[model samples]
Target: MTDKRIIKSSKVLVTGGAGFIGSNLVDRLLEQGNQVVCLDNFATGKRENLDLALQNKNFTLVEGDIRNYEDCVRAVKGCDYVLHQAALGSVPRSIKDPITSTDVNIGGFVKMLFAAKEEGVKRFVYAASSSTYGDSTNMPKVEDIIGNPLSPYAITKYANEVYAQNFTDTYGIETIGLRYFNVFGRRQDPNGAYAAVIPKFVMQLMAHESPIINGDGTFSRDFTYIENVIQANQLAAIVSYDNIKELQVGSKSVFNVAYGERTDLNQLFNILKKNLSEFDYKISDVNVIYGENRAGDIPHSLANIDKGKNILGYNPEYCIQRGLEEACKWYWENL
Candidate 1:
């Protein structure tokens, strides 16, 4: 059995705790007997995400924005571990409003780092992105090799890694960045224009609406499950400390949190459609409109998870199909 007791009694602060990934992380932390403080502005996150955690005695929900220094300071104070999951995600959203994305993703991230460092937190584990691979056409992207960021959102995420390294080198903060692939599971919003593809497609299919497939439907992704991401965050938070730096705390270094597998959009759609068809036989031939290709999206993305496996003992439990099935079920019932 996994040692879920590692974080017991630890006062942890999770920014964006009301968001999908952040709320999930908060749930896990509360389950482990940790005193979790959730700070979210709710720009994109919903209050419903933290409903379960609110019932826990150890969980405290703070409505605040990370961009504000006072809020960051208040949230970071007395926290043992800081899991920074707050950010404005989505490339197209960033492309449409680069300033808002920059202010929140980059500016807010830096503010959190400063506050965490000042508060003398034990460790900082943050959500990085596979989008950092940017224009690199490599089949399996490695951490050391990266390409120029194709979009403003990618640039902010990449800047986070650089800032983390800088904090380690200069301020002596302990930090680890988990580069997540296309993560999907329950609680992912499906109604927004900036919604992720999996939830968006599942919602459309369930609503008996046409799901638009961007590009040729051949574009692939290493769609990771939300549970795997929660596992990675826990591992990153409590890894044995060896050479602790001001920026990085744990014994293990940065790692790619993914299943190390590829699944194209076409295959993904078919899997979800087939699974949902069990409920409604006549749901076949749901119109799939292939529109113009997205600007910041990479043609394909696959991660080499050897680093995570060796360092954090990270093992992903679900593949794209399994994750999509669960996600589709949630959308069918909820959305």
Candidate 2:
């Protein structure tokens, strides 16, 4: 990991800093007393998410798009590290418009990489996705084994891993890719058609509305919390630049950031129902309505976080139930 001392002293640029995970990372980095510059175009990222960070003197928000090389350059200048969190997310959204998704996720990622490279950013960490494990049907997905992408969103993220390797091999720039699995927590938008399941369900229960399960409720995922993701980013940014070279040269070169366990929709529903019941007893009676399965969703997704554990010294502090309980409290007050 880059030295903790160096990370604290560093000025890091977080692309997509107004989005769910990015905004949370900005909060944590600012808490650590690091100068954080957030670059976002307010596409998927909401301005309200950065409210508290905006009040911090050390925080800077650049309203920009990564797809534009000049915007990428503006965001990268004078930064010690670059955390690439900006991307067009959601499988259904990508399916609706693959071209736009490709332009943002893949095209924008390359632009930021090049910008960081030119600016001599010490380390580059990006948000990779578990969807890249596409169609593999593998339980407890390991980093090395991956299958053909099932959606345009998956294709873009897989391309990111390949490109990160090439960037490291060809340009000698240090890069780290964290393949996130079902991340959720505070500031996670639950309103959109492409909202994440946990927050979406929480908001539904808050309104006493029935949440529709996309299948028989057997589909499962390793629902990681936002804090764990923030921890992974901090660790990724703190690695010694030399260690990054060794990792890029040696291992599978990508790490899965997750809870290393899976929870099916039925279990998730039960967990949310149980926790939210503390606020309203009627929530306990909210029935789930099952529907047709999503076209591109995997039956189950579990991450083998051995790489993150052994390499990054990561031990996720929140399990599913704990994360759910905390998220429930946040949604109860905020939603």
Candidate 3:
């Protein structure tokens, strides 16, 4: 395994800085004494997410859309590294409006990459998705073995991996892609139609309402915590290309950023209910409604995170139970 190196004394640009993952990353970066510039249009990102960040003198919020070339250019100026987290994330949302998703995800990705290249940023790190593992039924997903994409969102993420590689090969710009699994934690919006299952369930239970499961509650996922994702990003930004090249497949590489375990929906519900019940006893009695299985969703997901551990020194600190405990506490206090 590689030794961990924290990113400090540098300037970093986080594209979706006001979003859940981006804002969290921004906070950690700032804590490490790095100058952080956040580029977000507040489309899905919340202004409150960056409240603590706005207080820091080292943090700058650039209100901009990634789709516009000028906005991307303006964000990348004087940055040493680019953390590309700006993208429309939901599979259903992309299916409904593929054009807008494509324009923002694919089109905007290229613009940011171009801007990073022009600015001579040391490295470009992006958020890839586990949805890219579309039809593959592998027990543990490895970096190189991916099947056909199942949704428009998945296609866009896979295209990002391809584009990052192309940019690295053709322009010599360094890039790393962190394929995030079912990430959940604080600040995750639970009210949206495309809300993630964990936070959505948390909200329902808090309201003494039944949380709906899309399947028989047998389908499982490698639910990664936000803190683990922050560690992966910091490692990806600082790790040398030469050290990573020794382990990576090509000029650019992607690593699975997950907790390396799976938890079915039933177990997840029980855990959340149990955790939240500490604050509100009635939550323990909250029932769950099982619905039809979501189309395009796989039965199980488990990440073989050996690549990240060996190369980037990514050691995830939170498991499903631990993460849920933390998440439940945050929701109880904040919501």
Candidate 4:
């Protein structure tokens, strides 16, 4: 049996709590009997995501931006744990407007950290991205070995780790960074210019549009599910050890939050087509247009999740096919 003592009485704050992964974390936290506060600017977060939580008295919603110090301060006050998930994600979006991405991703993160430190939060856990693994050709990306960042977005996320470590060393804030690999699930927006692959494809297939494959469909990702991220956040929030002196606040001791598996684009497409074919057989096609390879995209990304499994007790319950099925159902019903 797992000990419930650590989180049972904690007051939690989830930044960007109205977004896909953040909202799901809010649900899990509230289910475990924690007093949860959600802070969001609604830049990318949808108001409908919080509909279920609004009925719960234990939940509070704060309209705010993390880039503003006062907003961060107000949100962090009296919170035991902070899950910072607010950021501008996507390489194309970042490439189009690097300034806004930097402001929200880097500037907002620093402000959140400073506020968390001042508020005396127990532990600060933020969403880190696998994009930090940039141009490195290694099959299974390890935490220690990283290559140069290829995009402005990658640079901002990498900078968050640097600032996180600096805050830990200079101040006394405890922090853990989970490098998420292509997280997708329910409540993920599929109607945006920067929509993620799974949701985007599901929507396209449902609408009878060809889901554009960026390259020759050989590109692949670990494609972690959102539930795994929720687990990581909860574990990181309550993780305690006797060695406080040896602990680094911004240590950037990162872990790959993935299932340690890889699925190529073509394979994933076939699986999606097979599953959706029950609804409409005409959707099955091997005719994805081969566009120019996107800039700043890595050829293949696989995570070595042993560290997460051993240290954080991370066990992902869904692989890509299963996850995509759930995602497709959600999109089909909602969109």
Best by TM-score: 3
Q: Supply candidate 2's per-residue lDDT for 257.
A: 98
What is the C-alpha lDDT profile of model 2 across 193-304, one tens digit per residue?
8999998999999899999999999999999998788888878877565644555433356789999988999999999999999999999999999999998888899999
Worst lDDT 10-window in candidate 4: 241-250
TM-score of 3: 0.97
- lDDT string for model 3 (1-335, tens) is 13347788999999999999999999989988999999999999999999999999999999999999999999999999999999999988998888999999999999999999999999999999999999897779988878888888999999999999999889999999999999999999998889999999999999999999997999999999998999999899888899866664652389999999999999999999999999999898899999998866778899999989988889999998989999999999999
> What are the per-model numbers of colliding residue pairs?
11, 6, 0, 4
Give the worst 10-residue stretch by lDDT in candidate 2: 243-252
The CA lDDT at 252 in model 2 is 54
TM-score of 1: 0.95
Better of 3 and 4 by lDDT: 3
Local distance difference test scores for all models: 0.86, 0.89, 0.92, 0.84
Residue pairs clashing, model 3: none
Per-candidate TM-scores read 0.95, 0.96, 0.97, 0.94
Best-to-worst lDDT order = 3, 2, 1, 4
What is candidate 2's CA lDDT for residue 27? 85
Please, what are the lDDT tens digits per residue for candidate 1 over residues 1-335?
Answer: 16452567799999999999999889988987889999999999999998899899888888899999999999887999999999999999999999999999999999999999999998899999999889887769877677889999999999898898788668888888999998899999988789898888877877778888889899999999998898888888887645333223332356799999999988888888898887777667686778889887899999999877767778888887778778777777876
lDDT of 1 at 324: 75
How well does candidate 1 score on lDDT at residue 70? Answer: 97
Instruction: Please report how far candidate 1 places residue 235 from its true position, in Å.
Output: 0.3
CA lDDT for candidate 2: 0.89
User: Candidate 2: where is the Cα deviation over 4 Å?
Assistant: 1-6, 241-251
